[model samples]
Target: MTRSTDRWGVTGTVTATASATRAAAPDSATVAVTALGEAASAARARKRARNRAATVRTAIEATVEVGIETVDHRVTNSAVTFEPETDAAFRAVEEFHVRCEPDAVATVVVEATDGGGGVDHVQFALTDTARADLQAEAMTAAVDRARRKADRLAAADGLAVGAARSITTQPARPGNEPVDDAWESDPSVHPAPISVTERVEVEYELTAAETDMTVANDSGKG
Candidate 1:
């Protein structure tokens, strides 16, 4: 028998790849309200936008006690421009983000978009705790799937599987990084389920021949 060992134990090596997917309702929501205005003067345009934003903020504070905190929200984008050569009007823009519970999202969005409101967008997302928990569960499921696969393949070849020699994950895609989830909020809308997937590749070493490969063979039948 030929034997070789480089990274994942001896030459009797088997590799298993699998992906686990999990779906859950979002736990929280974030609403983005953008206030924009145009006026003859820069200061006047800015004031108009701020006034409109304040009205929306007051509406939010009434619905939810959290209110739009100034420190939490920031001016993500802003600019001023002249209307034309003859016209000296300036346009102003400001955006504020509001974080609130999933249940309260509908109420807040309605208030923001009501009566020509300044709501640019409303988004739904999973809470930090929910995200972390789901990640752990998905990872466990992927590993279990890989191990089971390895066992069945080894049994078919009249061999027994040993400890994993190495384990690694495929490089994530360019835009696969975790990004803040957002959506347009509607009263009758239900938050979409959050789906998380975990992919893993494991290499296991062949220990010895299986005397009775009944379990591995039977499990694969179903």
Candidate 2:
């Protein structure tokens, strides 16, 4: 009959976080239109104001060259409201949300809305491709850090860290949230850095160290 020694192992659990950052540029802006008009008939006044607002929206769209520049735009709000004044007037207020790349184009979009509507919000953000790449980089760094910690811990206990048995990861979170960056007219100038952080918990297998193996052999001989 063959005798087998009981297997021994230790799980090293470690949590590590890593962050990656890139300069954020303006990726989107909001154009708000308030077209006001007064007519003898309420319906006519509302129609006229709404039509004017629609025209402004069309002009803004043309400036961006939607398909060519590959921009994402949508009408966020459109409503007609009346105010009590010397003469009843209807104001059609509409907001257009625009997002695109090569941030410099944002200036062109704002100019297009000029004389017709006002740009309400200009914001900075990371592109989808950039976000994905950074996330991968951060995750890799976190895993490496976890492995280093595991190795150190195992060394302390006269053990060798082996292959990872299991790994648990947390969703990546933005360290800094996107915000209005209208203060800087030039989107490329002194852009703020956006950081993404990722956390991971890893469990690694442990193997017997050389010293432990020597002691086991000595006991067997006795």
Candidate 3:
């Protein structure tokens, strides 16, 4: 409920948030490169690690043959020093976000890294086309919710709901984080449902009921 102006031009504004969920499988996974060696061989190890990372990235992009939608990678270097400050070894780490089928995730990562690194995280998300559809539905639901609330408030006050004067919506928020590892226990298992939420604010005009207008006319006559 929101503000109103005059008695005959009452307004009912409602803000509502509505959610829609879609069952999704793990379509993407994150993998970390574990390439470390003594400082003496840091230069050589870094090269090999980069090569391995490159190979993994290529494999990920070529997974579906038509090419996966997302394949991102970043490289980082860190040094671990012992009690003797001089005794330190550098490590080259590369992480990738690979899009692939849930069932083939392990196989792809293992084969790509030659059984060196392991899967770090798995995520579930709707494809671009599906996401757009879901967002539309969610937004509609939010607006409907606001409308219902406004109607109820108007009815309680002996007023009829009228045309919408204004409407506004916020961007939808889609959840795509790695929720669980149930896929590890069962390859065919689907990921948890992903929810998208949309918020809307609507302003509706409130008009006096016909009975109320008739009563006012009778009073004026008396």
Which lDDT values do the candidates have, in the order given? 0.69, 0.53, 0.54
Cα deviation of 142, candidate 3, in Å:
1.2
The alpha-carbon RMSD values of the candidates against the true structure, listed in the order shown, are: 7.4, 6.8, 5.6
The lDDT of model 2 is 0.53
Off by over 4 Å in 3: 1-39, 54-89, 101-103, 170-188, 210-222
TM-score for each candidate, following the candidate numbering: 0.75, 0.63, 0.63
> lDDT winner among the candidates?
1
Model 2 weakest lDDT span, ten residues long: 68-77
Ranking by lDDT: 1, 3, 2
Residue 193, candidate 3: C-alpha displacement in angstroms: 1.1
Residues 137-220 of candidate 2 have per-residue lDDT tens digits of 777788888888877776776677678767777664654433444534454454455566657777776767778878887888
Q: What tens digits encode model 3's per-residue C-alpha lDDT throughout 106-152? A: 55655545635545545545566655666677767777777788778
lDDT of 3 at 25: 40
